[model samples]
Target: MKKKVGLYFGTFNPIHSGHLIIANYMVEFSELTEVWMVVTPHNPFKKKSSLLDNHHRLEMVYKACEDYPNLKPSDIEFGLPQPNYTVNTLIQLEEKYPELEFALIMGEDNLKSFHKWKNYKVILERYSIFVYPRISKGLIENEFLTHAKITRVPAPIIEMSSTFIRKAVKEGKNIKPMLPEKVWKYLDEMNFYK
Candidate 1:
Protein backbone atom coordinates (compact mmCIF):
# COMPACT_ATOMS: atom_id res chain seq x y z
CA MET A 1 0.00 0.00 0.00
CA LYS A 2 1.18 3.50 -0.76
CA LYS A 3 2.00 5.74 2.20
CA LYS A 4 -0.04 8.88 2.75
CA VAL A 5 2.28 11.75 3.68
CA GLY A 6 1.04 14.93 5.30
CA LEU A 7 3.10 18.06 4.85
CA TYR A 8 2.79 20.33 7.87
CA PHE A 9 4.79 23.33 6.73
CA GLY A 10 5.61 26.09 9.18
CA THR A 11 8.29 28.38 10.52
CA PHE A 12 8.68 26.34 13.68
CA ASN A 13 10.82 29.04 15.35
CA PRO A 14 11.15 26.79 18.40
CA ILE A 15 9.19 23.61 18.16
CA HIS A 16 6.74 23.55 21.06
CA SER A 17 4.37 21.06 22.70
CA GLY A 18 1.42 22.39 20.75
CA HIS A 19 2.98 21.30 17.43
CA LEU A 20 3.81 17.87 18.81
CA ILE A 21 0.27 17.38 20.08
CA ILE A 22 -1.16 18.21 16.68
CA ALA A 23 1.22 15.87 14.87
CA ASN A 24 0.31 13.07 17.27
CA TYR A 25 -3.38 13.71 16.85
CA MET A 26 -3.09 13.79 13.05
CA VAL A 27 -1.28 10.47 12.93
CA GLU A 28 -3.62 8.80 15.42
CA PHE A 29 -6.90 10.13 14.10
CA SER A 30 -6.22 10.56 10.40
CA GLU A 31 -5.24 8.22 7.56
CA LEU A 32 -1.85 9.87 7.19
CA THR A 33 1.13 7.57 7.66
CA GLU A 34 3.60 10.31 8.43
CA VAL A 35 3.61 14.05 9.13
CA TRP A 36 6.63 15.82 7.68
CA MET A 37 7.20 19.18 9.33
CA VAL A 38 8.35 21.13 6.29
CA VAL A 39 10.51 23.87 7.78
CA THR A 40 9.99 26.85 5.51
CA PRO A 41 13.03 28.97 4.69
CA HIS A 42 10.85 32.06 4.50
CA ASN A 43 7.20 32.94 4.27
CA PRO A 44 6.58 35.10 1.23
CA PHE A 45 4.32 37.59 2.98
CA LYS A 46 5.93 37.61 6.46
CA LYS A 47 9.11 39.30 7.53
CA LYS A 48 12.02 36.87 7.20
CA SER A 49 14.15 38.41 9.95
CA SER A 50 11.48 37.80 12.57
CA LEU A 51 12.07 34.04 12.35
CA LEU A 52 15.00 32.25 13.95
CA ASP A 53 17.79 31.08 11.64
CA ASN A 54 16.57 28.32 9.33
CA HIS A 55 19.15 25.82 10.58
CA HIS A 56 18.43 26.63 14.21
CA ARG A 57 14.68 26.31 13.72
CA LEU A 58 15.14 23.02 11.85
CA GLU A 59 17.35 21.63 14.62
CA MET A 60 14.77 22.52 17.26
CA VAL A 61 12.10 20.79 15.21
CA TYR A 62 14.29 17.70 14.87
CA LYS A 63 14.80 17.55 18.65
CA ALA A 64 11.12 18.01 19.42
CA CYS A 65 10.07 15.32 16.93
CA GLU A 66 12.94 12.92 17.70
CA ASP A 67 10.77 10.53 19.72
CA TYR A 68 7.98 10.28 17.23
CA PRO A 69 8.56 7.99 14.24
CA ASN A 70 5.68 9.54 12.40
CA LEU A 71 7.04 13.08 12.73
CA LYS A 72 10.01 14.39 10.71
CA PRO A 73 11.72 17.66 9.84
CA SER A 74 12.13 18.34 6.13
CA ASP A 75 14.65 20.83 4.74
CA ILE A 76 13.37 20.53 1.18
CA GLU A 77 12.76 24.26 1.05
CA PHE A 78 16.38 25.01 1.90
CA GLY A 79 17.54 24.13 -1.60
CA LEU A 80 14.59 25.76 -3.27
CA PRO A 81 14.41 29.42 -4.30
CA GLN A 82 14.01 32.29 -1.83
CA PRO A 83 10.58 33.19 -0.52
CA ASN A 84 9.39 29.62 -0.94
CA TYR A 85 5.82 29.16 -2.03
CA THR A 86 3.67 26.16 -1.05
CA VAL A 87 2.45 25.38 -4.57
CA ASN A 88 6.01 25.12 -5.88
CA THR A 89 7.08 23.01 -2.93
CA LEU A 90 4.19 20.62 -3.36
CA ILE A 91 4.85 20.30 -7.07
CA GLN A 92 8.52 19.51 -6.44
CA LEU A 93 7.61 17.00 -3.73
CA GLU A 94 5.18 15.24 -6.03
CA GLU A 95 7.73 15.04 -8.82
CA LYS A 96 10.50 13.80 -6.50
CA TYR A 97 8.45 11.36 -4.44
CA PRO A 98 5.89 9.99 -6.85
CA GLU A 99 5.12 6.93 -4.76
CA LEU A 100 3.85 8.75 -1.72
CA GLU A 101 0.61 10.73 -1.69
CA PHE A 102 0.77 14.19 -0.11
CA ALA A 103 -1.72 16.26 1.82
CA LEU A 104 -1.55 19.89 2.99
CA ILE A 105 -1.85 20.23 6.77
CA MET A 106 -2.56 23.62 8.29
CA GLY A 107 -4.53 25.48 10.95
CA GLU A 108 -7.94 26.98 10.25
CA ASP A 109 -6.42 30.39 10.85
CA ASN A 110 -4.32 29.99 7.74
CA LEU A 111 -7.31 28.76 5.80
CA LYS A 112 -9.04 32.08 6.26
CA SER A 113 -6.33 33.83 4.30
CA PHE A 114 -5.46 30.92 2.01
CA HIS A 115 -7.17 32.47 -0.97
CA LYS A 116 -4.43 35.04 -1.03
CA TRP A 117 -1.96 32.27 -1.88
CA LYS A 118 -0.69 32.11 -5.43
CA ASN A 119 -2.58 29.48 -7.42
CA TYR A 120 -4.77 28.67 -4.44
CA LYS A 121 -7.28 27.00 -6.73
CA VAL A 122 -4.67 24.57 -8.02
CA ILE A 123 -3.72 23.66 -4.44
CA LEU A 124 -7.31 22.96 -3.44
CA GLU A 125 -7.86 20.78 -6.47
CA ARG A 126 -4.60 18.85 -6.32
CA TYR A 127 -4.27 17.89 -2.65
CA SER A 128 -6.34 17.09 0.41
CA ILE A 129 -6.24 19.62 3.25
CA PHE A 130 -6.19 18.70 6.93
CA VAL A 131 -7.11 21.67 9.10
CA TYR A 132 -6.61 21.95 12.83
CA PRO A 133 -8.27 24.74 14.75
CA ARG A 134 -6.47 27.58 16.50
CA ILE A 135 -7.77 30.46 18.62
CA SER A 136 -9.30 32.33 15.71
CA LYS A 137 -12.70 33.02 14.13
CA GLY A 138 -13.08 29.25 13.66
CA LEU A 139 -13.13 27.24 10.40
CA ILE A 140 -12.92 29.22 7.22
CA GLU A 141 -16.07 29.50 5.15
CA ASN A 142 -14.84 29.68 1.60
CA GLU A 143 -15.77 28.55 -1.90
CA PHE A 144 -12.87 26.11 -1.88
CA LEU A 145 -14.61 24.14 0.88
CA THR A 146 -17.07 22.70 -1.62
CA HIS A 147 -14.41 21.04 -3.78
CA ALA A 148 -11.61 20.40 -1.28
CA LYS A 149 -11.27 17.34 0.89
CA ILE A 150 -10.99 19.17 4.19
CA THR A 151 -10.68 17.16 7.39
CA ARG A 152 -10.90 18.81 10.80
CA VAL A 153 -8.57 17.15 13.25
CA PRO A 154 -9.33 17.49 16.96
CA ALA A 155 -6.05 19.17 17.94
CA PRO A 156 -5.96 21.01 21.25
CA ILE A 157 -5.88 24.78 21.07
CA ILE A 158 -2.79 25.58 23.09
CA GLU A 159 -2.56 29.29 23.86
CA MET A 160 1.22 29.18 23.56
CA SER A 161 2.93 30.68 20.51
CA SER A 162 6.47 31.18 19.23
CA THR A 163 5.96 34.92 19.48
CA PHE A 164 4.92 34.65 23.12
CA ILE A 165 7.72 32.21 23.87
CA ARG A 166 10.34 34.46 22.28
CA LYS A 167 9.02 37.44 24.21
CA ALA A 168 9.10 35.44 27.44
CA VAL A 169 12.66 34.33 26.82
CA LYS A 170 13.78 37.84 26.05
CA GLU A 171 12.22 39.00 29.33
CA GLY A 172 13.89 36.19 31.32
CA LYS A 173 10.71 34.22 31.86
CA ASN A 174 10.55 30.44 32.19
CA ILE A 175 9.16 28.23 29.39
CA LYS A 176 9.57 24.86 31.05
CA PRO A 177 6.29 23.28 29.98
CA MET A 178 5.69 25.24 26.80
CA LEU A 179 8.61 23.73 24.88
CA PRO A 180 10.16 20.29 24.63
CA GLU A 181 13.05 19.61 27.01
CA LYS A 182 15.66 19.08 24.28
CA VAL A 183 14.58 22.22 22.48
CA TRP A 184 14.80 24.18 25.72
CA LYS A 185 18.30 22.86 26.32
CA TYR A 186 19.33 23.80 22.78
CA LEU A 187 18.00 27.33 23.24
CA ASP A 188 19.84 27.64 26.54
CA GLU A 189 23.09 26.30 25.11
CA MET A 190 22.90 28.57 22.10
CA ASN A 191 21.68 31.55 24.13
CA PHE A 192 18.94 31.99 21.58
CA TYR A 193 16.28 34.68 21.93
CA LYS A 194 18.52 36.42 24.48
Candidate 2:
Protein backbone atom coordinates (compact mmCIF):
# COMPACT_ATOMS: atom_id res chain seq x y z
CA MET A 1 0.00 0.00 0.00
CA LYS A 2 1.17 3.53 -0.70
CA LYS A 3 2.17 5.47 2.38
CA LYS A 4 -0.56 8.04 3.05
CA VAL A 5 0.65 11.36 4.45
CA GLY A 6 -1.51 14.31 5.45
CA LEU A 7 0.05 17.72 4.91
CA TYR A 8 -0.98 20.21 7.60
CA PHE A 9 0.33 23.55 6.42
CA GLY A 10 0.61 26.44 8.86
CA THR A 11 2.77 29.42 9.74
CA PHE A 12 3.50 27.89 13.16
CA ASN A 13 4.89 31.22 14.37
CA PRO A 14 5.30 29.40 17.62
CA ILE A 15 3.99 25.88 17.50
CA HIS A 16 1.28 25.49 20.10
CA SER A 17 -0.57 22.63 21.78
CA GLY A 18 -3.73 23.13 19.75
CA HIS A 19 -1.82 22.47 16.54
CA LEU A 20 -0.47 19.25 18.02
CA ILE A 21 -3.87 18.13 19.23
CA ILE A 22 -5.31 18.34 15.73
CA ALA A 23 -2.33 16.72 14.07
CA ASN A 24 -2.21 14.02 16.72
CA TYR A 25 -5.90 13.34 16.27
CA MET A 26 -5.52 13.03 12.50
CA VAL A 27 -2.64 10.60 12.77
CA GLU A 28 -4.19 8.52 15.55
CA PHE A 29 -7.82 8.40 14.48
CA SER A 30 -7.74 8.79 10.73
CA GLU A 31 -6.31 6.65 7.92
CA LEU A 32 -3.25 8.88 7.61
CA THR A 33 -0.03 7.02 8.33
CA GLU A 34 1.69 10.25 9.31
CA VAL A 35 1.05 13.97 9.49
CA TRP A 36 3.60 16.49 8.31
CA MET A 37 3.31 19.99 9.73
CA VAL A 38 4.43 21.96 6.71
CA VAL A 39 5.82 25.33 7.85
CA THR A 40 4.77 27.90 5.32
CA PRO A 41 7.32 30.53 4.28
CA HIS A 42 4.56 33.06 3.80
CA ASN A 43 0.79 33.15 3.78
CA PRO A 44 -0.66 35.58 1.27
CA PHE A 45 -3.59 36.35 3.52
CA LYS A 46 -1.53 37.23 6.59
CA LYS A 47 0.72 40.22 7.10
CA LYS A 48 4.47 39.54 6.93
CA SER A 49 5.37 41.87 9.80
CA SER A 50 3.75 39.68 12.43
CA LEU A 51 5.49 36.53 11.25
CA LEU A 52 8.74 35.32 12.71
CA ASP A 53 11.61 34.38 10.46
CA ASN A 54 11.16 31.15 8.50
CA HIS A 55 13.80 29.21 10.44
CA HIS A 56 12.45 30.30 13.83
CA ARG A 57 8.97 29.07 12.97
CA LEU A 58 10.42 25.86 11.53
CA GLU A 59 12.46 25.28 14.69
CA MET A 60 9.37 25.70 16.84
CA VAL A 61 7.52 23.15 14.72
CA TYR A 62 10.50 20.80 14.99
CA LYS A 63 10.54 21.19 18.78
CA ALA A 64 6.78 20.71 19.00
CA CYS A 65 6.78 17.45 17.01
CA GLU A 66 10.03 15.84 18.23
CA ASP A 67 8.36 13.61 20.83
CA TYR A 68 5.69 12.34 18.46
CA PRO A 69 7.10 9.81 16.02
CA ASN A 70 4.04 10.00 13.78
CA LEU A 71 4.19 13.79 13.47
CA LYS A 72 6.87 15.52 11.39
CA PRO A 73 8.16 19.06 10.80
CA SER A 74 8.58 20.01 7.15
CA ASP A 75 10.26 23.10 5.63
CA ILE A 76 9.50 22.19 2.03
CA GLU A 77 7.84 25.53 1.36
CA PHE A 78 10.91 27.45 2.49
CA GLY A 79 12.74 26.72 -0.75
CA LEU A 80 9.74 27.46 -2.92
CA PRO A 81 8.91 30.90 -4.32
CA GLN A 82 7.48 33.56 -2.04
CA PRO A 83 3.68 33.75 -1.66
CA ASN A 84 3.52 30.04 -2.44
CA TYR A 85 0.11 28.59 -3.14
CA THR A 86 -1.13 25.27 -1.74
CA VAL A 87 -1.51 23.85 -5.22
CA ASN A 88 2.12 24.62 -5.95
CA THR A 89 3.29 23.14 -2.69
CA LEU A 90 1.27 19.99 -3.34
CA ILE A 91 2.80 19.69 -6.78
CA GLN A 92 6.29 20.07 -5.39
CA LEU A 93 5.67 17.51 -2.67
CA GLU A 94 4.39 15.01 -5.22
CA GLU A 95 7.46 15.50 -7.37
CA LYS A 96 9.83 15.08 -4.41
CA TYR A 97 8.12 12.05 -2.92
CA PRO A 98 6.49 10.15 -5.73
CA GLU A 99 5.93 6.99 -3.73
CA LEU A 100 3.91 8.69 -1.00
CA GLU A 101 0.25 9.62 -1.48
CA PHE A 102 -0.33 13.15 -0.16
CA ALA A 103 -3.54 14.48 1.39
CA LEU A 104 -4.50 17.87 2.84
CA ILE A 105 -5.38 18.49 6.49
CA MET A 106 -7.44 21.61 7.11
CA GLY A 107 -10.13 23.17 9.28
CA GLU A 108 -13.79 23.53 8.23
CA ASP A 109 -13.44 27.33 8.25
CA ASN A 110 -10.93 27.15 5.44
CA LEU A 111 -13.31 24.99 3.47
CA LYS A 112 -15.63 27.95 3.20
CA SER A 113 -13.07 29.82 1.14
CA PHE A 114 -11.43 26.88 -0.62
CA HIS A 115 -13.10 27.87 -3.82
CA LYS A 116 -11.32 31.24 -3.88
CA TRP A 117 -7.90 29.65 -3.55
CA LYS A 118 -5.58 29.58 -6.48
CA ASN A 119 -5.97 26.36 -8.45
CA TYR A 120 -8.27 24.96 -5.78
CA LYS A 121 -10.05 22.88 -8.38
CA VAL A 122 -6.80 21.20 -9.31
CA ILE A 123 -6.11 20.39 -5.66
CA LEU A 124 -9.55 18.83 -5.30
CA GLU A 125 -9.18 16.79 -8.47
CA ARG A 126 -5.75 15.42 -7.55
CA TYR A 127 -5.63 15.06 -3.78
CA SER A 128 -7.79 14.03 -0.84
CA ILE A 129 -8.65 16.56 1.87
CA PHE A 130 -9.10 15.71 5.56
CA VAL A 131 -11.10 18.46 7.27
CA TYR A 132 -11.34 18.90 11.01
CA PRO A 133 -14.12 21.03 12.51
CA ARG A 134 -13.78 24.66 13.61
CA ILE A 135 -16.03 27.10 15.47
CA SER A 136 -16.46 29.65 12.76
CA LYS A 137 -19.34 31.63 11.30
CA GLY A 138 -19.19 31.00 7.56
CA LEU A 139 -21.12 28.23 5.86
CA ILE A 140 -19.22 25.57 3.93
CA GLU A 141 -20.14 25.30 0.26
CA ASN A 142 -22.58 22.51 -0.50
CA GLU A 143 -20.30 21.20 -3.21
CA PHE A 144 -17.58 20.53 -0.63
CA LEU A 145 -20.11 19.01 1.78
CA THR A 146 -20.75 16.25 -0.73
CA HIS A 147 -17.36 16.20 -2.41
CA ALA A 148 -15.84 12.77 -2.98
CA LYS A 149 -12.28 13.70 -2.01
CA ILE A 150 -13.07 15.65 1.13
CA THR A 151 -13.48 13.63 4.35
CA ARG A 152 -14.74 15.24 7.56
CA VAL A 153 -12.79 13.86 10.48
CA PRO A 154 -14.37 14.35 13.89
CA ALA A 155 -11.29 15.81 15.52
CA PRO A 156 -11.57 18.06 18.56
CA ILE A 157 -12.56 21.65 17.91
CA ILE A 158 -9.50 23.63 18.99
CA GLU A 159 -10.27 27.33 19.25
CA MET A 160 -6.76 28.64 19.51
CA SER A 161 -4.99 31.12 17.28
CA SER A 162 -1.38 32.17 16.83
CA THR A 163 -2.39 35.81 16.82
CA PHE A 164 -3.93 35.49 20.27
CA ILE A 165 -0.88 33.67 21.54
CA ARG A 166 1.40 36.38 20.18
CA LYS A 167 -0.70 39.11 21.71
CA ALA A 168 -0.66 37.44 25.09
CA VAL A 169 3.07 36.88 24.95
CA LYS A 170 3.71 40.47 23.97
CA GLU A 171 1.61 41.62 26.90
CA GLY A 172 3.76 39.48 29.23
CA LYS A 173 0.96 37.06 29.85
CA ASN A 174 1.83 33.47 30.80
CA ILE A 175 0.68 31.80 27.64
CA LYS A 176 2.69 28.69 28.33
CA PRO A 177 -0.43 26.57 28.67
CA MET A 178 -1.29 27.30 25.06
CA LEU A 179 2.01 26.01 23.72
CA PRO A 180 4.09 22.86 23.89
CA GLU A 181 6.66 22.87 26.68
CA LYS A 182 9.59 22.84 24.29
CA VAL A 183 8.03 25.50 22.08
CA TRP A 184 7.23 27.76 25.04
CA LYS A 185 10.78 27.37 26.31
CA TYR A 186 12.19 28.27 22.92
CA LEU A 187 9.91 31.29 22.55
CA ASP A 188 10.70 32.49 26.06
CA GLU A 189 14.42 32.01 25.57
CA MET A 190 14.34 33.89 22.31
CA ASN A 191 12.13 36.66 23.82
CA PHE A 192 9.90 36.50 20.81
CA TYR A 193 6.61 38.36 20.32
CA LYS A 194 7.45 40.80 23.10
Candidate 3:
Protein backbone atom coordinates (compact mmCIF):
# COMPACT_ATOMS: atom_id res chain seq x y z
CA MET A 1 0.00 0.00 0.00
CA LYS A 2 1.16 3.53 -0.67
CA LYS A 3 2.15 5.60 2.35
CA LYS A 4 -0.80 7.70 3.45
CA VAL A 5 0.45 11.14 4.49
CA GLY A 6 -1.74 13.95 5.76
CA LEU A 7 -0.62 17.45 4.89
CA TYR A 8 -1.45 20.01 7.57
CA PHE A 9 -0.74 23.27 5.81
CA GLY A 10 -0.35 26.48 7.85
CA THR A 11 1.88 29.50 8.27
CA PHE A 12 2.98 28.17 11.66
CA ASN A 13 4.18 31.73 12.41
CA PRO A 14 5.11 29.77 15.45
CA ILE A 15 4.15 26.14 15.84
CA HIS A 16 2.28 25.67 19.12
CA SER A 17 0.82 22.77 21.05
CA GLY A 18 -2.59 23.17 19.47
CA HIS A 19 -1.07 22.32 16.10
CA LEU A 20 0.70 19.31 17.56
CA ILE A 21 -2.52 18.06 19.14
CA ILE A 22 -4.38 18.14 15.86
CA ALA A 23 -1.55 16.57 13.92
CA ASN A 24 -1.04 13.99 16.65
CA TYR A 25 -4.71 13.14 16.85
CA MET A 26 -4.96 12.64 13.12
CA VAL A 27 -2.07 10.18 12.98
CA GLU A 28 -3.30 8.21 15.99
CA PHE A 29 -6.95 8.12 14.96
CA SER A 30 -6.80 7.97 11.19
CA GLU A 31 -5.16 5.90 8.46
CA LEU A 32 -2.43 8.47 7.93
CA THR A 33 1.07 7.10 8.38
CA GLU A 34 2.34 10.54 9.36
CA VAL A 35 1.24 14.16 9.38
CA TRP A 36 3.48 16.69 7.67
CA MET A 37 3.06 20.26 8.78
CA VAL A 38 3.51 22.31 5.63
CA VAL A 39 4.65 25.79 6.59
CA THR A 40 3.22 28.31 4.17
CA PRO A 41 5.36 31.17 2.84
CA HIS A 42 2.39 33.49 2.87
CA ASN A 43 -1.35 33.25 3.09
CA PRO A 44 -3.46 35.11 0.57
CA PHE A 45 -6.15 35.92 3.12
CA LYS A 46 -3.73 37.14 5.78
CA LYS A 47 -1.57 40.25 6.03
CA LYS A 48 2.04 39.81 4.97
CA SER A 49 3.21 42.45 7.47
CA SER A 50 1.96 40.32 10.35
CA LEU A 51 3.95 37.29 9.25
CA LEU A 52 7.46 36.34 10.30
CA ASP A 53 9.93 35.59 7.52
CA ASN A 54 9.22 32.22 5.87
CA HIS A 55 12.64 30.88 6.84
CA HIS A 56 12.12 31.90 10.46
CA ARG A 57 8.64 30.40 10.56
CA LEU A 58 10.00 27.25 8.95
CA GLU A 59 12.81 26.93 11.51
CA MET A 60 10.40 27.39 14.40
CA VAL A 61 8.27 24.57 13.01
CA TYR A 62 11.34 22.37 12.74
CA LYS A 63 12.12 23.06 16.39
CA ALA A 64 8.56 22.37 17.46
CA CYS A 65 8.24 19.11 15.51
CA GLU A 66 11.60 17.62 16.39
CA ASP A 67 10.17 15.64 19.29
CA TYR A 68 7.36 14.03 17.34
CA PRO A 69 8.61 11.25 15.11
CA ASN A 70 5.43 11.18 13.07
CA LEU A 71 5.09 14.94 12.79
CA LYS A 72 7.23 16.44 10.00
CA PRO A 73 8.14 20.07 9.32
CA SER A 74 8.18 20.85 5.61
CA ASP A 75 9.57 23.84 3.68
CA ILE A 76 7.99 22.75 0.39
CA GLU A 77 6.53 26.19 -0.21
CA PHE A 78 9.92 27.86 0.11
CA GLY A 79 10.76 26.54 -3.36
CA LEU A 80 7.43 27.63 -4.83
CA PRO A 81 6.57 30.99 -6.30
CA GLN A 82 5.34 33.99 -4.32
CA PRO A 83 1.63 34.21 -3.44
CA ASN A 84 1.41 30.41 -3.57
CA TYR A 85 -1.90 28.62 -3.75
CA THR A 86 -2.82 25.29 -2.19
CA VAL A 87 -3.67 23.56 -5.43
CA ASN A 88 -0.25 24.34 -6.83
CA THR A 89 1.50 23.20 -3.70
CA LEU A 90 -0.42 19.94 -3.63
CA ILE A 91 0.35 19.36 -7.26
CA GLN A 92 4.05 19.84 -6.76
CA LEU A 93 4.15 17.65 -3.67
CA GLU A 94 2.35 14.84 -5.38
CA GLU A 95 4.69 15.11 -8.33
CA LYS A 96 7.77 14.97 -6.15
CA TYR A 97 6.52 12.21 -3.84
CA PRO A 98 4.42 10.12 -6.14
CA GLU A 99 4.79 7.07 -3.95
CA LEU A 100 2.73 8.58 -1.17
CA GLU A 101 -1.02 9.07 -1.21
CA PHE A 102 -1.67 12.52 0.30
CA ALA A 103 -4.59 13.76 2.35
CA LEU A 104 -5.49 17.33 3.29
CA ILE A 105 -5.94 18.21 6.94
CA MET A 106 -7.73 21.27 8.31
CA GLY A 107 -9.96 22.37 11.19
CA GLU A 108 -13.75 22.22 11.05
CA ASP A 109 -13.90 26.01 10.89
CA ASN A 110 -12.14 25.87 7.52
CA LEU A 111 -15.13 24.03 6.10
CA LYS A 112 -17.07 27.30 6.35
CA SER A 113 -14.93 28.69 3.54
CA PHE A 114 -13.86 25.48 1.81
CA HIS A 115 -15.72 26.31 -1.32
CA LYS A 116 -13.82 29.54 -1.77
CA TRP A 117 -10.52 27.72 -2.12
CA LYS A 118 -9.06 27.73 -5.60
CA ASN A 119 -9.70 24.52 -7.54
CA TYR A 120 -11.50 23.14 -4.52
CA LYS A 121 -13.50 20.73 -6.63
CA VAL A 122 -10.37 19.08 -7.94
CA ILE A 123 -8.99 18.81 -4.43
CA LEU A 124 -12.08 17.14 -3.03
CA GLU A 125 -12.29 14.78 -5.97
CA ARG A 126 -8.68 13.67 -5.88
CA TYR A 127 -7.62 13.64 -2.23
CA SER A 128 -9.10 12.82 1.15
CA ILE A 129 -9.65 15.51 3.80
CA PHE A 130 -9.47 15.10 7.55
CA VAL A 131 -11.28 17.85 9.47
CA TYR A 132 -10.52 18.43 13.12
CA PRO A 133 -12.45 20.84 15.36
CA ARG A 134 -11.79 24.16 17.08
CA ILE A 135 -13.21 25.26 20.44
CA SER A 136 -15.58 27.84 18.95
CA LYS A 137 -16.88 25.54 16.23
CA GLY A 138 -16.81 22.19 17.90
CA LEU A 139 -18.87 20.50 15.18
CA ILE A 140 -20.05 21.15 11.70
CA GLU A 141 -23.20 19.78 10.03
CA ASN A 142 -23.73 20.43 6.36
CA GLU A 143 -24.16 18.76 2.99
CA PHE A 144 -20.41 18.73 2.65
CA LEU A 145 -20.23 16.80 5.90
CA THR A 146 -21.79 13.87 4.06
CA HIS A 147 -19.37 14.08 1.18
CA ALA A 148 -17.34 10.91 0.72
CA LYS A 149 -14.09 12.86 0.52
CA ILE A 150 -14.45 14.48 3.94
CA THR A 151 -13.92 12.75 7.27
CA ARG A 152 -14.60 14.55 10.55
CA VAL A 153 -12.16 13.19 13.07
CA PRO A 154 -13.41 13.26 16.68
CA ALA A 155 -10.43 15.18 18.00
CA PRO A 156 -10.93 17.64 20.86
CA ILE A 157 -11.08 21.32 20.03
CA ILE A 158 -7.78 23.04 20.76
CA GLU A 159 -8.32 26.44 22.39
CA MET A 160 -5.08 28.18 21.55
CA SER A 161 -4.08 30.75 18.96
CA SER A 162 -0.81 32.05 17.48
CA THR A 163 -2.22 35.57 17.78
CA PHE A 164 -2.81 35.13 21.49
CA ILE A 165 0.69 33.69 21.88
CA ARG A 166 2.26 36.53 19.90
CA LYS A 167 0.42 39.13 21.98
CA ALA A 168 1.57 37.49 25.20
CA VAL A 169 5.12 37.36 23.91
CA LYS A 170 5.12 41.04 22.94
CA GLU A 171 3.83 41.95 26.38
CA GLY A 172 6.67 39.98 27.96
CA LYS A 173 4.34 37.32 29.26
CA ASN A 174 5.31 33.66 29.44
CA ILE A 175 3.48 31.52 26.90
CA LYS A 176 4.90 28.16 27.78
CA PRO A 177 1.47 26.56 27.85
CA MET A 178 0.82 27.34 24.19
CA LEU A 179 4.22 26.34 22.84
CA PRO A 180 6.56 23.40 22.82
CA GLU A 181 9.37 23.78 25.36
CA LYS A 182 12.05 23.95 22.67
CA VAL A 183 10.10 26.41 20.51
CA TRP A 184 9.35 28.65 23.48
CA LYS A 185 13.00 28.58 24.48
CA TYR A 186 14.10 29.34 20.93
CA LEU A 187 11.68 32.24 20.62
CA ASP A 188 12.74 33.65 24.00
CA GLU A 189 16.45 33.35 23.21
CA MET A 190 15.98 34.88 19.77
CA ASN A 191 13.74 37.67 21.10
CA PHE A 192 11.20 36.93 18.39
CA TYR A 193 7.61 38.14 18.25
CA LYS A 194 8.54 41.03 20.58
Highest-scoring model, lDDT: 2
What does candidate 3 score in Cα RMSD to the true structure? 1.6
Over 4 Å off in model 3, which ranges? 136-141
Report each candidate's C-alpha RMSD, comma-separated, in the order given.
1.4, 0.7, 1.6
Give the TM-score comparing model 1 with the true structure, all chains together. Answer: 0.95
Clashing residue pairs found in predicted model 3 = none
Clashing pairs in 2: none
* Candidate 1 global CA lDDT score: 0.88
lDDT of 3: 0.89
TM-score of each: 0.95, 0.98, 0.95
Local error of candidate 2 at residue 85 (angstroms): 0.5
CA-lDDT, candidates in order: 0.88, 0.94, 0.89
Of 1 and 2, the candidate ahead on lDDT is 2
- The alpha-carbon deviation from the true structure for residue 3 of candidate 3, after best TM-score superposition, in angstroms, is 0.8
Better of 1 and 3 by lDDT: 3
lDDT (10s digit) by residue, model 3, range 104-186: 99887887688889998999899999988765534454657799999889998888889888888999897887899988888
lDDT of 3 at 51: 88
Give the alpha carbon lDDT tens digit for every residue of 65-142 in model 2: 999999999999999988899999999999999999999999999999999999999999999999999999988999
